[model samples]
Target chain A: MPTIRDIARLAGVSVATVSRIINHSGKVRPETEKKVKQIIQETHYQPNQVARTLYQKRSKMIGIVVPNLNNTFYAQVIDGIQSVLQKNNYSALISFSTSSDGSKYLEAIDNFKNNNVDGIITSAFTPPANWNPTTPLVMYDSADIQDKIVRISSDNSKGGQESVKLIAKNVKKVLVQHWPLSLPTIRERVEAILKELNRQNIAYVLEEVSESDPYLAAQQALNKRNTFDAIITVNDPYAAEIIKEAKRRGVNIPKDFQLVGYDNNILCEYTDPTLSTIDQQPHLIGQTAATRLFKMMAGDTSTNNDIINVIPIKRNSTY
Target chain B: MPTIRDIARLAGVSVATVSRIINHSGKVRPETEKKVKQIIQETHYQPNQVARTLYQKRSKMIGIVVPNLNNTFYAQVIDGIQSVLQKNNYSALISFSTSSDGSKYLEAIDNFKNNNVDGIITSAFTPPANWNPTTPLVMYDSADIQDKIVRISSDNSKGGQESVKLIAKNVKKVLVQHWPLSLPTIRERVEAILKELNRQNIAYVLEEVSESDPYLAAQQALNKRNTFDAIITVNDPYAAEIIKEAKRRGVNIPKDFQLVGYDNNILCEYTDPTLSTIDQQPHLIGQTAATRLFKMMAGDTSTNNDIINVIPIKRNSTY
Candidate 1:
């Protein structure tokens, strides 16, 4: 609980002399420095970062905001960001908004600004037109909105095209199960899929489903029996549900119909008839965002966005 | 970019008066406060948390350390902690130590202390004998080490016993796939399982497996097929891998052998035939750890450890 004044009083020196010794600035006699160091050690006095930050004008902290961590995709992204932060000797003030709403994101941003963060990196959220951020900001998990900020987004159009190409040879009619197109990221993928299917002259039907109860959506997809020869699910978990429901109904995968999923998460390999999905390289997205944030923090002003490529994983689920 | 001094100069008031108005600490004339506030709004000035923390001695920050985020178990724990943090209006300084080694954990602790964290909550790791932490420290994912610190641990013994009782009716012999017993948590479960099996007079064979390449472990376990009627895996993902390998080998679950895993993660439901596992309530553990940490930070001196109950989930993997 001792302050720098206490250390100076105990060492029989001026507070300015003590500050010079502590910060390794200004000239101080060796004897005075030795005495002050001994007293500090005896008192177990730790230098206060708060006080140092006042003079330095840098906290060496970056504020990060993510929607949630329950999904491995986000977890991997954080891990990637953490690795870079570790190497650079930086700490992160993390806020999990637990929602995609712009209000929650705004609150987090306000909190970070109050903490004097040098920069911020957050998942995609639409900011109000009039609310301009003063801090350097970078975003990920976006659809490349290009609204005066740098964004690191996965190649969704390429992902959608690959999803179609993965099962193209085996399908005459396709069923695409997806969530709301209101989400910009999802809209990009769905649009790309439709465009690709049309170019291939393949017939397709779009089915909107709920992401929460994916099992119900899977069962409904299977209830359509021979209506479609293939199903492209929203993600791997949704596709896994379809596989489970198919097993319950005694229908064989790849024999009766083929299935493909997006976001090649851990479930892709664990699911029976292993899921063929798109790998968005979530880690790369995080690394790129953090790297860009550091550049901005160092006074870089370029706002050009970046894109990461996706990989198509050919597992047994698809022909 | 505007400092408090600049705001005071622009408003023609003393810096102390500006500070008082910003903190709402001292009474000032209504006109003076209004003039200062108008300048502040025009300048877009944010009060530096570091300066406020220096006077108040409260950072409104908690340092959190988790082993890794790649697993859903840890992510859920972090989510639980975030929920409580949001409610309390606090931010988390998170450090993800990619290893279970004490050295990595110690480094994180040092970093948190240097940043003046109010308290710390970390996953289990052994500290050096002479390393006495001055901060309020709480641990989760522990084995109830009774190390003179508060701990929130899952009831590993009960989880082990439940795993045994779930398949006791159908199994004459069991295959227990596990990792190193040097880990305190894993050792506790293995000991409890052995005691339960001894009480039931069921024969068993202990097989050590590499957690990283669980598919190979599953293949190895099935190579000794028909020797044991049931398999107790280290965790849910390992069990999922077994199911995948079993399908490839034409081995039926619950018909050829009953299987049970630990930590009822999301993968438990997605796996074919489903999976019976022990739910350690990771979120509750995190919430309890954080709640206990806040109490300690509030000057509570008690150092008692707490345990969270585990639930047994029955599915088609077990009879």
Candidate 2:
């Protein structure tokens, strides 16, 4: 509730002088600046962000665009971003772009612009063509969206190789199950696994499952129970379901077949025997993205193109 | 961008008449309301929510208190609630109270109140002392939070019993793996399983694992490989991790052991062999909570004390 007048009175200065000190707009003696700052600290004076934003045309806010909130994989990454942003006094406005129409993603960008947000962090959704955001942007996972100055991604290819290689080491043949085979994480990992399998003379199957129909995965797994000795899935949720269908048909994992999931999602730990999957360090990714955004805002121009690689967490399912 | 004056001019009425029509205020003639509504529709005049909120002292917003965004289980429930709330023209302000101390939950509540939100949809964050909310509240899954007008929860007992029964049918022996055995879901399910095992003369071993630590689960499962034939976790994440650990030990799942998970989290479909777990229908739970919150705000008392039951989702994890 402390106002500019209160701080000015405590600092033995005019309200205008206090404003000058806070905004660094005008000449202030070093001693006067110290006095005003001390008074502000003592009075616990926090400026009204809304009023300041309207005049300055910028709020220390960012938009985080996510494809799904129901996936813990994305949630973990959000938490990481929150950790870093919270420390730097930046507020994040979250939008889940689930419809796939891209309107929600476009709306998010528009909302941030109208709200005078300083930056944006996108994970899957693309921006609109009608309105090009001049704000600083940091993108995650996908490199499809253009105009973002900085990008951060987990080395999905390495993770895939690590995941499938562990399985091929034990089981002579492994089948990689995926839906929407066009997805980058799925396709790239499959490409890496297929190469490794061919090189090692290990049999591998690339089964494309439809993500739209929830029942298709179980039905497909049921149809191909014996064609493979191991199953490496795109993520933990699919991996868990595969385990379920395999069990109903009287298949034992890592015995009759081995299994591996990706994204070391929190679900991976709580799974029946525990799911061994790749750990992308989602929190780290978020933190890095936020940090990079801050640097850009502060006028740092160093470009980082190194694809961050998180190690695969080996667990009960991988052997 | 059409204003009340524009609508009034088109409808041949005063601006106040248009205001009455838009605000749903009293003493507006039916003819005026119809004419103004038509004009408003023709012009596609969207009311400025923030400006209206300042005048009406209503945010048209709802506070969603969650344990943490890290858990996809709760996120699924939140998504379900958000989907409904968004359709009803409400905005969801989310807060995560997964701190070591529970006091941050108080801050989120106060923040919502400060923003003048119309209602709150909260999940399991214990409120601070002497804090009473003037807004309508809908609390999810707190058996102990005492308030006659605000509570909704799944039938934890039934879910526990179903999870236990499914494990019993598939595996000769079952292991109750969970996070902080003190959690209501974990505790209730464990008690229910003990009772079921005693009644059926089924062999079982209940293991309490820290919800935060998976390394402990890995070590314990390795040491007791001979003891448990199945592991039933309180949530999908735990079940997924257990599945991973069992794999690393060279133990074949469902051949040597069966695994049952809870929350039937969307992630359940991704784990290798998929997870056979109890589906609590989290989306319905959230949707119900948001609907009730809106109704309560509108002074309706039609919603009942909900005790939804979990439906079993049979997958491959059990033979």
Candidate 3:
């Protein structure tokens, strides 16, 4: 590894100057730092991490608080953000708070802050509106924060509307599958879906089950046999369970009953009739979230903290 | 947070000795270090991270390399390990390498090494026979590295057998979705599956797809419209694609064909038939990998690095 001294010599600067530039130490002329950086890049010199940590006095880490890593949606988003962060040499401290309450989320965030994380990406429920961390913060799909913090999410309303419209076109009586409206985002989706069905004059049953909890959702859905012509799920996995149980009862999708799910997760494409699902462009959402976080950390204060919505992707589930 | 003085008083050590122990300085005796750690635990005194970094010159960061983060099998495994790492102060540098070639894998490993990462978690193709690292290492789904490293994986042979039996019961003609046996693990699975099928007096077609890509495998299978009755995919996502395409062509599952997938990924559940899939227990495997890495780092030199087989879980896709 080329030491700072080697780069300093190559750039005609003292080792002290090189260190100053690398650590963003006070008052090195911008032109001089640029020249040093040029030489460092050319030499493929990766600063010795051990020495840099000592000088920077900060862990170049982003504290990422996700609700459920087992959930496919959050998992994909984390993968996306991690991909970008890896390129920037920033490590992610990922914490999965599968707990229903916000206590673990708060603890994870507080702990990460104590660890001197450079920034934080967390769910909205974890931190109070008045809460402020030493580092930068961003929220993913949180409505409670409103316009207070950077928020990234897909168009849940549009997704719900589209799924409703799909069901309206194909089936007469449909059962909208869902978990309890635990999050405001899910509630918004449920509302939008109902509104769309009303607008279309499509007769539907609002089957409110604990769809997010896989075991309960499957068991509950199984208990209700032959009630509707189709079922629309809040998310893809829940849709999977409904379809499986429906099949066990000899219910045929798009034949005896149509099935549609939201979030065209990888699983959506694999279902027997290939579930028609409303898409949130999960990968793009990930890319957008990371880029937005980077921009905020880079001192973009004017960014509207209001929900930034991603467009829905229509797939086989609708048709 | 409590300062070193408080810890020193608690441990009956001098202020300077406490500093050395908490900062990971070599001058402090091991016994003193242990005492300091205990005090830290009892008090829950998370030191100023900035101060800790200044003295230790280490960030306690680790790196993880997965073949594809989008793949649920790997994603679940990552979730399991990340659950533990997040609790500790270790941040993870996550990366995905497309090629299974050891060079791409090595590139990621070297990145972690150069970053002064405390350890590594790699979903390796085939781990090196005597791979040793200055930092701790954990290998997932890799085998035959002697007792020098940690390895975690599902029983591919058993997964294969379970899949075949599941498919055979429903469909007389089954298609084994796979690529050429370049890897011994893949070869073992293929052989075990054929052996089981032969014993069952089943007539199966070995549909060898040249590409290991999921979409390609699905497309190739789709092209053979009536070539098979039941489709067994190499992985969950691959099985998903077959189901999607088969449905697009109006082929009803269980009516026209039976479908089974491996990796019992969330995709299996979301699929229309709720995918009869072989669950590889990725979560348990991931936890094991992290635990083993800790052991290896703590100077455990006698871990069995042979293939650690986890049982496959059966889900809805089968009969």
On TM-score, the candidate that comes out on top is 1
Top of the candidates by DockQ:
1
For model 3, the docking class works out as: acceptable
Give TM per candidate: 0.91, 0.70, 0.79
Q: Candidate 2, residues A10-55: lDDT per residue as tens digits?
A: 7889987877776667799999999889878888786654544533
* iRMSD, all candidates: 1.4, 4.4, 3.3
Scored against the true structure, residue B245 in model 3 reaches a CA lDDT of 75
lDDT of 1 at B112: 85
Q: Mark the 10 consecutive residues where model 3 chain B has the least summed lDDT.
A: B306-315
lDDT of 1 by residue, B1-319 (tens): 8998999999999988998898778899999999999999999998877777765667889999988898899988888887787778889999888788899998888888877888999999988896778899998999977768788989999999999998898689999999999988999999999999999999999999995888889988999988999999899989998998899889999899999999998988878778999999989888888898889989999988999999999998999
Q: Provide the lDDT at B190 for model 2.
A: 71
Task: Tell me the spans in candidate 1 whose CA falls farther than 4 Å from its real position.
Answer: A1-46, B1-45
Candidate 3, residues A1-319, lDDT tens digits: the string is: 6888899889898988998887777789889988998998899987765456556755667788877656677777777777778778776766667775777777777767766677888875745667666567777766533565677756777777877766676567777777678677788788888888888777777777763476577566557646766677777777766666666777666676667777766665555555777766656566667778787778877546544454454554455
Minimal lDDT window, size 10, model 2 chain A: A142-151
Residue-wise C-alpha lDDT for candidate 1, range A1-319, written one tens digit per residue: 7888999999899988887887778999999999999999999887776676665666778899988888788888888888788889888899987777899999899988777787899999999985668999999999977778788999999999999998898589999998899999999999999999999989999999986888889888989968988899899989988988898888888788899998888988877778999999999898999999889888898888899999999999888
Higher-scoring candidate on DockQ, 1 or 2: 1
C-alpha local distance difference test of each model: 0.89, 0.71, 0.71
